[model samples]
Target: MQFDNIRGFLFDLDGVITDTAALHAKAWAGICQRLGIPWTDALAEGTKGVSRMDSLEVILKSVNRQDEFTMAQKAQMATEKNDRYQELITHLTASDILPGMKDFITDLKQHNYQLALASASRNAPTVLKYLGLSDVFPKIVDPSNLTKGKPDPEIYQHAAALLNLEPGQCIGVEDAPAGVASIKAAGAIAVGIGDAHDLAQADVVFPGTASLTLTALRGKLEDGVLNA
Candidate 1:
């Protein structure tokens, strides 16, 4: 599981690196309820970290409400949720940034590790910029451009290429099962940051980022922890 070959890191935006998922789930659930659709737990979870349109598609299919929603209604509902999402995210402060993300990014940069933001969230750029981590990752592959969402390799592959590294030469850090699958599918080693039930595809499972400092991560990397 050592990552001695790792030249860069590919990171998922939501949950792993940010707290936007709860907001999104709340918004999606509200929209579904308001539209008279049953917002089931499985439906909300399956759509986590996915794009707005794709999330809607999954939710609709889950509730068997695809037949109930017209294309126009779907668009309006997505817009409504996104509007609320935007408003909610705009309220984010530095306190909202995860415990050690800023220091982790700073340490990584100082160590010359290439960084990339590979998020299924379409709102990634604005949120990252707002959180002041925008400049940390020079490469980003957001949800809008991916042909297939998470559980698909396109986003991770695209992200590695954008970062100018081979999938084998980079490590993908993710929280969701779909993101882990995407990383493995892209030929990268997946490091699960939380909730192994959703991240069986990952190579390493770490409970939380509190103990995931750069020194600790580098220790694991040197010990052959990631792709060993």
Candidate 2:
């Protein structure tokens, strides 16, 4: 599973590379409050790796109002959530980047590995800049512009295409099951950044980025290559 031969690395934002997942949860909670819907951690977890509109639909379903809102109204609420999320993340700093990520990314860059982003968030640019990481990824696939999100493979595939690499030549890292599935569907090796069970579909799972090192990742990838 050695990543030595991998040409590019695709990373998911929010929970995978930063602590912004909490900020996103807060925004979702705020929207739930205005809509009189009960928000819980279990419910919030369902929105990870999903587009804004898809997240809104999850919220609407939880409140039993999914059918009540028209497409226009849902779009407005999604915009409202994004506005709130933008404000909350305005105070983010370098400390917000997940532990070990900076070092790992630098290591990858030193090895001449191309970097790209495959996140479902439309605010990817803003968040990257807020965390002082706007330069790391030159290729970012905007899921908002696509009709499909995670689990559809479109985003990850687009990221690989933009990086001028085939999906099999790229490794996609994510913390969400849907994201892992998306990468796998795109023919890329999926590196899960969360609980192994939660990301069982991933080729290999690391507890978190803090526990991942360039050497260890390469070892895992090399092993996968051998096994395959």
Candidate 3:
């Protein structure tokens, strides 16, 4: 909205820029099946916008199995899931980028807005490369060393810092509640790309990437502030 003060943009990887959310779900489903954990849409949704380990914990705790695995076992499971996810993403191409996202990025760059990837995925760079967007976002927040993930402001804050901008000067685009919460916690505008009711906390909500445009975003502002 308005975005007069926004100098940069922080983006999540999965549902925001690409359709890899389905790939991630498929990987997790494989893990669940192997572990005999009942998989459901609710469990899959819980993994959105979170780190791999956090998602694993979510699945484990769903059935009171969190304490069953040792650190090494959990690590192995995570690795397996990532391996599957990576294999699934091997077919990705520029055509897989969400509708209108590339154009939106171009518009933002044309307007001199800095951008960075703030995804929880450690494979963010690889995914970007596959999408032919490696140069589009040179600064991707390193998830490996982050002390906290989405729903904590650390990742968004780190992304803003990478751009040499304050959190309030950036817009965070997310398709999950955790990511929206993180952006809001970081004192940035939260732009949700999903169901309005699901992302009720966002400063503004759009149904999908196809609706993400500077003019449309600005039109959502009321007195220079976003109207959710």
Per-candidate local distance difference test: 0.81, 0.87, 0.93
Best by TM-score: 3
List the candidate numbers ranked by TM-score, top first. Answer: 3, 2, 1
**Any idea what lDDT model 3 has?**
0.93
TM-score of each: 0.91, 0.95, 0.97
Of 1 and 3, the candidate ranking higher by lDDT: 3
Candidate 1 residue-wise lDDT, 14-114, digit = tens: 87777787889888988878867787778767887677888998888875777787889889989999988888888876677777777777787887888
Clashes of 3: 0
Instruction: Write candidate 2's Cα lDDT for 30-65 as tens digits.
Output: 889998999988787899889998898888888689
lDDT of 3 by residue, 148-190 (tens): 9889999999999999999999999999999999999999999
Maximum-lDDT candidate: 3
For model 2, give the 10-residue run with minimal summed lDDT: 219-228
Residue clash pairs of candidate 2: 1-220, 1-221, 1-222, 1-223, 1-224, 2-221, 2-222, 2-223
